[model samples]
Target: MSTRTSETTVTFGHPFRLAAIGDAQPAGTYRVVVDEEEILGLSFLAYRRTATTLETPAIAVRGGPHAFHRVDPADLEAALEADGKAPRSV
Candidate 1:
């Protein structure tokens, strides 16, 4: 079985950033950059590409112009395992 892998090198911190490259309701390609490690994912919008790249007015949210459903490392591991695309040790 072949696998797919993506590489990201940004560590995440409080108020990390996520980039969705498509719609407003998150329905397309997405990227989350945290701690220099990027996690590629999907969404349900088209214009939400900048969801995590800026500051929005609080309490005036619009259901993501582009956003990522925060995922835990363990869950991420599971995803990588499922696809057999986890990075290898050098």
Candidate 2:
């Protein structure tokens, strides 16, 4: 897997709890995608995900299953800078 390329679909058998987001994703099927790259035999995973289901909002992001590169931490600043946007304070 590339540092930002692993992807898959995952459905929650029960209500899934996301402590980071502080939201309990209801029991339902969802697409779980992980963006990470492999470097020197080490894998760096991203917390960001393209979680999707057959429903509202995130449909664009999580609607159809597709491949996308994960945004690596090292590249984030440079990318944002190139985009002419201020880096997020957080």
Candidate 3:
């Protein structure tokens, strides 16, 4: 199987905190990175960019005119582990 990764830019409309990422991310344009996989029957959402790293388990709140998709936090943690990175705190 081939692994798929996606990169995109997003603006944080609100403040959000992620474990191990250090500090709360403010509203701004961020570069997100995500690997494709089927987790808990949900799609993969890209991680938010932090000051010095990327935040995982992107809370995929797919809304509006786009297709709805969401990934479980547990699944995202697993994905991080599979990638040999520290899993986000539960």
Candidate 4:
């Protein structure tokens, strides 16, 4: 069994955190997410075990749930304008 001992909150550029946790000996990685209003989301990704004990895992922004080509800021702005939502501030 495992339990969370510590947690760090980040609220700057992105909205997520990477945490690595595991048994007392081994550790695993988990991506934690919080919404703009600060609500915990889902947890995923369980890779195979390694030889050495695992340490803290990594966390990152969701970066969207779909894959697509990168778009320039100007183009993204135009897209958002077309969609009627204001361009993102960050």
Which candidate gets the maximum TM-score versus the true structure? 2
Candidate structures ordered by TM-score, highest first = 2, 3, 1, 4
TM-score of model 4 (CA atoms): 0.24
Alpha-carbon RMSD, candidate 3: 13.7
What is every candidate's alpha-carbon RMSD to the true fold?
15.9, 13.5, 13.7, 18.7
Assess candidate 1 and give its TM-score to the true structure.
0.29
lDDT of 3 by residue, 6-64 (tens): 66544445555445444554544444455664334337644432222243333453343
- The Cα error of candidate 2 at residue 41, in Å, is 8.3
Ten-residue stretch with the least lDDT total in model 1: 45-54
Clashing pairs in 3: none
Over 22-88, each residue of candidate 4 has an lDDT whose tens digit, in order, gives 1121122222221122223438533321111111222343353522222233443343344455555
Q: Candidate 3: where is the Cα deviation over 4 Å?
A: 37-90
lDDT winner among the candidates?
A: 3
lDDT value, candidate 2, whole model: 0.38
Pairs in clash, predicted candidate 2:
2-36, 2-37, 3-36, 3-37, 3-38, 4-36, 4-37
Q: By TM-score, how accurate is candidate 2?
A: 0.37
